[model samples]
Target: MAILITAKNLKKSYGKGKNTVHALGPIDFTVVEGSFTIILGKSGSGKSTLLNLLSGLDSPTDGTLVVAGESLNKLKSGKLAKYRAKIGLIFQFYNLLPNLSTLENVMISSWLKGISVSKQDATSLLKQFGLEHRINSNIKTLSGGEKQRVAICRSLINKPAILFCDEPTGALDTANGQIVKDILVKLNKEGMTIVMVTHNEEFIPMADKIITMKDGIIESMNTQISK
Candidate 1:
């Protein structure tokens, strides 16, 4: 498989000098095209930081990050937005607008990107996640799982080459988490590359490879047997 995302000795820090804190890396990694890769770590283990760096939501303090052949270090803010449109990111929190309906929430980015998509197609994708009935419903009324599903829908609105998920199931109950996992699996089968950060042990069995991190470094990268 071709490499869709690559990192070379990637490093990040907070503050400077005496106040500086090394958050993650000086680590090297890659995500292959159409693969499902998981990064696992406990709280404060830099899982979210690494995801943010990879997704270009945060800049690295040192080293290099390349996604889908674009060098993040070389791109300016405007170009970064265009580059980011090809790489979808889903946060632990749904991050939906309170006044927007679920369908409208999913369509926001696409609208900004100037994609000519209809409400009909947006309705269809949300319905695929069993959210059709709630299409016109305000985001504030949805459950945690439902909100996350809307986030997933929003992430896919642009049909990105790679999807970066930060603790995707962190707020969901077990059943809903499993449902989200299944949705990810289905997306993977359809040839979408998925790189997820999670502490949930249940996700381990679903990963093609599990990479563990601790103390701002990668501890191990293990390939998993099929369940």
Candidate 2:
């Protein structure tokens, strides 16, 4: 597979001098195209920090990060916004507007990215996720699983080159989490490049690569065939 993301001694720190908090690397890693990659660690392990850096949510204090041929660490605000549009983001908490219907929630993401998505396409995505019946329901009225499925549909509406997820299934119950996990696996199998961070070990075995972190550093990395 081709390299879709590459980091070289990537690092992030906050504050300055004596009060500084070194939150993440001085680390290096690569994500290959069409691979399911997981970054696993407990809270404060810097997994989220790594995800933020990877997704261009924050810039590195030092080192380099390149995704989809653009250097994230070096991009200006406008360029960074453009880079971000090429990716999709999902989080533990479904970040949908409670006032909006499921269909509206999905359509909004494309609008935010400067792309106009028709209602038909958005509905099709929701229908494919088994959420056809709830597409007209307000997010506040939907169950947790329904809310999350809407989030997934919203993320995909832009046709992002990479999907970046942070604890995607962490907020769901067992059955719902399984549904989310299965959907993710299905997406990866269908050629979505996914990079997810979570505290759950259950996701590791199913991924093409696993990066384990502890205390803001890599503890180990393993590669295996996708399950």
CA lDDT scores, all candidates in order:
0.87, 0.91
Q: Lowest-lDDT window of 10 residues in candidate 1?
A: 218-227
Q: Candidate 1 at 15: error in angstroms?
A: 1.6
Across 1-227, the per-residue lDDT of candidate 1 in tens digits comes to: 89888889899999988999999988898888988899998878887889887787877888889999998866677888787777788888867888888988999869877787788888899999999889999899999999999999998988989999988888889988988999998998999989999888777877887889998899998876574
Error of 2 at 39 (Å): 0.5
After superposition, candidate 2 runs with Cα above 4 Å error: none
At residue 70, give the lDDT of candidate 2: 85
